[model samples]
Target: MFVHFGLYAVAARHEWVMNREEIEAERYARYADVFDPDLFDAAALARTAKQAGARYVVLTAKHHEGFCLWDTATTDFSAAEALMAMCRELQPHMIVNDRLGIPGDLVTPEQYQPSRPLERDGVPVLWEACQTAPRDAALFAAIGEWMHRHRRAVHGAGPSAFTAPSGVTYTQRGDRLYACLFDWPFGLLHLPDLAGRVRFARLLHDGSELRMREIPQAQQAFNMNPAAPPPGTLTLTLPTRKPEVALPVIELLLWDSP
Candidate 1:
């Protein structure tokens, strides 16, 4: 009720459109227009993302300034012409809201209220709080304390320092000398390399040149599926097969996959 009321309040107060073209143009100026819908044909973007080895395509139908890619009956200035027709013409496509406000009584399944991710504003816990509850200083602080490691957020929280084990070398007794990781997804251990790969093998405590190999990708059990992660962790080890060897340097590489 409060959520609807808030949206209503904001919407009602928003200036009523005086002219349609200006409204659409303003949408772009406000950074509200993300996807032109016309720029990329439906089949084309999918093919391109697949061929480019991109895992996902973020079509910015809307941003903070509030623009939607498709036509909205709600507004006269809604997307028309190019892509609006595509959504109606296309098939086998599914859309999950990139923005799910908050979960629970504040939101209903049909109306949609999703928990916000922190990566948008750059700071995970603390910065995320600013984005979501920017006015609420106490809430952000509490979140920051809860996410001391800063890796606990739903989306990437940008570059923050982390701790790792200390060891220069170890015995790869039979096959591998490995390390352990707790409280993280099995994806790339780090991020922020626009160059598209993370190279951090230099942090190995044991100091042995680490070989980059494709370890079998492990599927996270449904129980571990994340709407959010409970304060949890896991252990990871590598194969070395020696009694004494330089510690392995692990490089976390992020790339889209099939």
Candidate 2:
């Protein structure tokens, strides 16, 4: 069974209310404030699926509008946090595609391997390359986050050469600088390139604010070596608990062009 439920249902027009009606994000987000799923019954739905001989169930936890169906620390615009917990208990291996929100390993490399072509009349068949190995839940979430938030920002500046720990990459879109952290940092993350440029910082997953501070030149040298970080290095204090997403993105609202 496949379920498609979201804030768009409140509009009563269609699932594509944001796109079809050309509704702005600010306007569309209002529906979440008033969203009430009074008739939702996860257990009953599971029972019905079982009676219908369904093997598995899938839920669209998040949609194109970025409304989450499950309770998330990342956002308050969720239908119900208990819904996800209930669904998990009912179906341990239940598949969830949060519409680029929380894609739970639906496609694996083994399942989406390259197809071998069969020859006919000694003519080799042309086969397209399978580009699925590198694609994971995190990549989808990143793509969705970019489209939902930073798509309108200019993208010609290319990647930033910011100094930071490994597994971190920076991309600039106008005044907004996105830090894609493949590996979650411990308690603090430092970016020397964004010394005095940052005006605000927040995690894209839940829109939670992060605290930042500038490291003075006096503290730049650890052992009086040339490899020390330069002065004016900005340090961001991250939350102890990481978000539920595969890849966490830090959206920095810059005071000047990055």
lDDT by residue for model 2 over 1-258, one digit each (tens)? 455689987887666779988998899889989899999888976765554444456566876677877777774534544556677899887554332233332322223533333233675432222232231434444555544543322234344445545777676777778887888877778887677889999987668899988755555445532233556678888887777765678888989773
List, residue by residue over 1-258, the lDDT tens digit for candidate 1: 001111112333322231322445544353333322244356754554444333355554543344444567654444443334454468325433323442211112343332332333474432211112223435434433333322212223233232233332121212222232333223333211112232323223344443332222353446643232122222232443432322123333324311
Error of 1 at 75 (Å): 7.4
Q: Among these predicted structures, which one has the highest lDDT?
A: 2
Residue 240 of model 1: what lDDT? 33
Per-candidate Cα lDDT values, in order, are: 0.32, 0.65
Cα lDDT of model 2 overall? 0.65
Report clashes for each candidate as comma-separated counts. 22, 2
In model 2, the Cα lDDT at residue 179 comes to 83
Give the TM-score (vs. native) of candidate 2: 0.39
